[model samples]
Target: MKITVSNWFKSGSPWVWLNAGAVAVSVVMVLGLLALIAVRGLGHFWPTAIVAADYTIPGNSQVQVMGQIADVEEIPAQRLVDAGLPKPGNKALIDRQLIKVGNRDVSGSDFVWVVKPWLQNVSHPKDAIALERREWGNFYGFLKDVRQNGSVVASGTEAWAALQDSIERAEDIYSQIYKIEKKEIGHINSGLERLRLKERSLELKGTNTPEALADIAASRAVLDAEYKVLEKELGDLYAAFTRDSIQAQTIDNNIVDINVSKIVRAYQPNAMGFFGKVGFYGDKIWEFVSDDPREANTEGGIFPAIFGTVMMVIIMSIIVTPFGVIAAVYLREYAKQGFVTRVIRVAVNNLAGVPSIVYGVFGLGFFVYFLGSHMDQLFFPEALPSPTFGTPGLLWASITLALLTLPVVIVATEEGLSRIPSTVREGSLALGATKAETLWRVVLPMASPAMMTGLILAVARAAGEVAPLMLVGVVKLAPSLPLDGNYPFLHLDQKFMHLGFHIYDVGFQSPNVEAARPLVYATALLLVIVIAVLNLSAVAIRNHLREKYKALEI
Candidate 1:
């Protein structure tokens, strides 16, 4: 056979052209996605402008809409008194209310001010929602303070302490009720004991003579009379206690009473910043990251979402890495290439192809409902009918993702194992190294990059998954952080917020969908960035390993 080698390339091979076309299409798709994210996400930080305004009440009872005030300066205290403005709260003479008396109707409706320049003489009084003429920096400064100081800038803690004191007060009230109820319960229980004693005594009545029987009857009459009195007292006490507890609880849980304690313990600076309102927004991410879920608008920002996303990814990584590596090692290093092995491999691959939504259902049905219900039955019989694992939870979500990504890890690892020379294994055996030692010390180090590659892919997939999480563990909002200061800190069964789902919720589920559209784009951009960062870091680690092992040509 004459072996002739040609340097010429194939000009018309459809396979070559087809591969190039595929690569081009992939590149375009990736680049387009990146561009879209950048344009929308990065745009959220741009500054917006605001205008000044003045309002005047009509002489007649009508809605008055008025405009521009001519250079209305904040009246200093002395100026305020000279102008005869009301001096309320703690302020210098200039601490009087701000007002603007403009001539025309071209007033500012767009720009906002917290300490708005109120016209000293109000011609119109309908507009109470006065935006101050304070600089936007005031808003940013307020947010910064909240971020640094954490809710209590001044009397926030006092308010919380007062609330706590109220809670203790409620406890005292309950204790008093319990004490009252205890006396009645004791009487009822005593009567029951007497009745039981009488029953027992009757059993021995047959053994006694006529004189003994007469004496027993007399004693029984006294006990029976006592039982009637006890029963009557218990009935009265139960009725009274039931009514009292219900009444007290109604008072304890009163909207006004609860809000009063909340009001006392709440963080309400006389001059509130934008962060103060973040809690008021009632958003889930804000609740974890800020103090007042309702009153806090910006203070309860997305920091908690960032924290949670990172934490969840870390948890998933921990769960998947070891099991994945072990499975791969078994398949490639030990398993025989027979019918069973082929079947297992096929099953693993098929598992990867399973819809993530299906995995979520599996997690909910098996992990949460079946397993959790069983656990509750075994451990917490007292709390029956309440779920243990029957509720959606973070642990189930993590485990589900781990199972979902297991195939990737296994396949990559097996490929890496196959690439290692059989001679290396033989050589290690000849040198008296055990198979276990060789596999652990030699095979593992070489296959690390492949293992990491699998993990990276798995993480990317898991990070963006929303449908599965929606069914299994994701909640619209949770009052407490999944990880918190509570005992046994990481509450895995607790539900959590996610950026991917947040985008969907804000964009679709929000009452003000139009207002939330921009936020949706921004959230999507952030999620993509997070996933990219994780993937890039994993790739960097894989590269480092590749460089480290270049000398050991597998």
Candidate 2:
């Protein structure tokens, strides 16, 4: 039997095929994007061999260059000619290489572009070293000597091993210093501040008695003594940290002395084998996830950003879920189905389409400025003028996101409630079950999967939101996390870092574009992973709930 085209259309097979094709295309696109992101981002951790080359400009003498080849591209010869660069004869396209010459303090630039035709005698020297620093970016050179107290203690073949030993010592000292400065000293400072605030509160209440003053003074003295002890320990550590230095010879043959404390790691990339490179890559990836960021967030780990993002999402979930469920129940189960109810539903749906930044503005005005200011005035008057609760912070950011995603939860729950057979309600009523009891014991449990579905959507949306968070609380860098071991533990009033904001800052706001570029990709990939993990957790819970209630659906 011949199938007519009209009959095929009538059978809906064409539409089904079209939909499947569209879905296939979409999945492929998504996977392709993820693959691209992974390649660009993850590859940044791998150590590339440093190339030592002689580069000659069109009208200048040959110059020695040492660095890793960061990127290579072909550009139209005409474009180079237009920019007053002499084009190599008869070539339509010129291949240019971007070299990351990381002695930023000396060369004044992290990267330089060189035309391929002008590069001569390129070789990777075995002795060449790449130093990852805590500041001034990376340094590419050769180790000359290891110095102790400005005197050469090790040189020639012995220098590398000695340098490694010194770096280990310095790192240990550095860790101690970090603990003292960031944790012990920090705790003391917080205590002092609280004491000061208490004193101020007493004064404000006209209770500044001599006994109260004595108590405050005694507390301040104890804190001051602790700080002094930490200060002395920090000084000793710093002295040890700066005791050793390394002399490195740059491409220009100039020897520069770098303190051991400033160096994060030094490696001879040219001498590394595949396994060595793999080990180095693993270390770099670990550092990216575990270390604190340095150099305007272009370098170091994004652990703080990851922490803040997860914490905010969790807080937002906690706040939005119950409120959303309640509102949904009221609308679907109790409210009369009339013009007012329909209007309310319409308004809720429309809100889901509103621009996220608008929610930020509303949250700032209503939640932060008005409500938060009132909260500060009422409860935290001692911390007044500092704007404790009356500021953009973790709590405000979470609340803002909760509000932004509330409509989704409400709509989803209402739909779930609507899907229950009316006979289920009738059966419950016939069995002498109260409405509240039925909702608590039967209705809500069955609707939990839908609620979880709504939460998944909310998290997927909220986790990726950068614009609202920017206005509410997210910052370029947060010194401390919102949740800490401090009193009242989860300090919701603290401003915090976020992966989304970190990506934006690294991508756009950084001074070193070349250095920051790879980091942008890495951060974006991490943010996507974080969102996926959060969503998957919710999805798993949702699936479990659905399976648990499957028998009751009839």
Please list the residue runs of candidate 2 whose C-alpha ends up more than 4 Å from where it truly belongs after superposition: none
Put down candidate 1 lDDT per residue, 1-554, tens digits, no spaces.
44333322344456687899999999999889878776654443322221223332223232222222212234455543454543433555232222221111123222222223332333321211121111110111011111111222223323333433443444454445444444444444444444444444555445456665676667667766766775676566444333211001110122111111111112222233455544433333333344322221111245555656777787988999999999989888888879999999999999989998899888888988898888867765444465646688788888888888889888888888888888878888899999999998777888888998999989899998888888778766665567754434687877887777776777777653333555566667778888999999999999999889777754
Off by over 4 Å in 1: 1-29, 51-300, 380-385
TM-score of each: 0.56, 0.98
Worst 10 residues of 2 by lDDT: 480-489
Q: Model 2, 509-529: lDDT tens per residue?
A: 999999898888899899999
Model 2 per-residue lDDT at 336: 95
Q: TM-score of the candidate numbered 1?
A: 0.56
